[model samples]
Target: MIAFENAAYSYGGGELLSEISLRLAPGSFHFLTGPSGSGKSTFLKLCYGELMPTAGRLTLFDREVRALSRDDIALTRRRIGVVHQDCQFLDHLPLAANVALPLTVAGRAAPAADLSDLLGWVGLGQLADALPPSLSGGERQRAALARAIIMGPDVILADEPTGNLDWDLSLRLLTLLVELNRMGKTILIATHDLNLIRQAKSQLAARVLRISKRRIQLAGADL
Candidate 1:
């Protein structure tokens, strides 16, 4: 569903990603691992069209990313769900409204029943009426996930999704991603948690990619 050919990205006269090439097949599951400032987030941004490469080509869902217009990218984003390190939510809005924001921004209204069910799925059913500041870190994360998938996106990209959670909470989030993959949603998660990656491997066939030296390589260990 996504491919990068000899892609390179640079900022402030420094190259963070260089000549990187990758292909994510439809319904495939993959994990991206790297140290801080190692370009994992940069690569994910490139994949989702947030950052255009300085050179080479990035193809997301068949069309070249750089060639896509702003509106085209916005439309394409509806088919791609993204969970960021810091869950972006409207501080004043209720959790349910936050989860439903994607649909609203896309000019579609999600049914009230479906919205409630989705919030329930993320264990936020009761917290739907609460504002973003009232929720804990894990709660916000799940809320973000609910928002991302509410549109029934074909692909899910998560960057440090469980960064603030404990081991148990992290596993819970991982389980949700695995379930999404089982349902044929392509998944790419960027995280520094090797143990989480190992846990994911035990339950699913997830390819591990490590970013280093300005390129991406398949991890050699069973990570």
Candidate 2:
């Protein structure tokens, strides 16, 4: 669904990512690993059109990202879900409202039953009325995942999703992602957690990619 050809992104002095060439096909699961500041998040941003390549080509859903208009980019984003390390949300909004924000922003109304079912599926049914600030780290991560998928995006990009959670919570989040993958969502997660990647491999087929010295490389079998 997304392709990068010799894609390079530069900022604040030099390139953060260079010569990135990869295709994220439908129903594929990929784990992106790299050391801190190695441009894993930058690559994800390029995939979703949040950032454009400074050199080379990046395309989303068969359209060149650089050629897309602002509205086009916005429309394209509806087909992609993003989860961040911070799980950004309006602190004062209730979890239900937060999860429904995508629908609200798109000028669509969410059915109450569907909303309830989604929250319940994420194990947040009882905490729907709680404010985001009141949630624990794991709760917030699950809420973020819930909000991300509410739009029914074709692709999911998560940057450091398990960064703040413990092993158990991280595994729970991974399980949710694996379920989504089984349901045919294209998944790309950028993380430093090798153990988490190994755990995912035990349950599903996942390709691992690593970034080093501003280049992307296929991980070795020993990963």
Candidate 3:
């Protein structure tokens, strides 16, 4: 589980997040929603240790984030899988290599058969040898999702994952996430798509959290 205890963050004398306290329970699914520049991405960064809190405690799996060294943080990140708004990848590498990157970074080789199977699961099998720069928005998002869970991570954090995709593609990605949650992986998605959230309500027990007024709240039905 990930949590923030009285947490606050500031950048260049401007407060981005303040008194932000929340918990991501294990095996749970949540959607982080808010207007632009509301610190939704910053909160996701804190969850994955990309940014440390400026005023309070940020804990992951019971350990205080500030107490961990850089190496320790990297190791901890292995337990987490993050999908960025703009799916970062090695443009020069083939789709397969990009999706299997976590394994490559860990010095573990992924078998061709397993790699192919993973790609197939995400409907990218035929494009396994294609370069990242060639895939469409949905394909890249799917590839990012495939890469994230390739390591079998315990926690998944995605920021605006479907921001650039069409409705059908967005629904497809959401279905993939819901499937992952059914497999017991905790999932948190930061998005502004209210229609997507409403659609998800019928398929999964997902909670909506809104970052507003320098704090986090369990956004009521207004979402």
- Considering every candidate listed, which one attains the maximal lDDT? 2
Tens digits of per-residue lDDT for model 1, 150-171: 9999999999999999999899
Tell me the spans in candidate 3 whose CA falls farther than 4 Å from its real position: none
Clashes of 1: 0
**What is candidate 3's CA lDDT for residue 27?**
96
lDDT of each candidate versus the true structure: 0.92, 0.94, 0.92
> Per-residue lDDT tens digits of candidate 2, residues 65-125?
9999999999999899999999899988899999999899999998999999999998999
Candidate 1 all-Cα RMSD: 0.8
Q: What stretches of model 1 exceed 4 Å from their correct place?
A: none
Superposition error at 47 for model 1 (Å): 1.2
Following a full C-alpha superposition, what root-mean-square deviation does model 2 have from the true structure? Answer: 0.9
TM-score of each: 0.98, 0.98, 0.98
Error of 1 at 68 (Å): 0.7
Q: Put the candidates in lDDT order, highest first.
A: 2, 3, 1
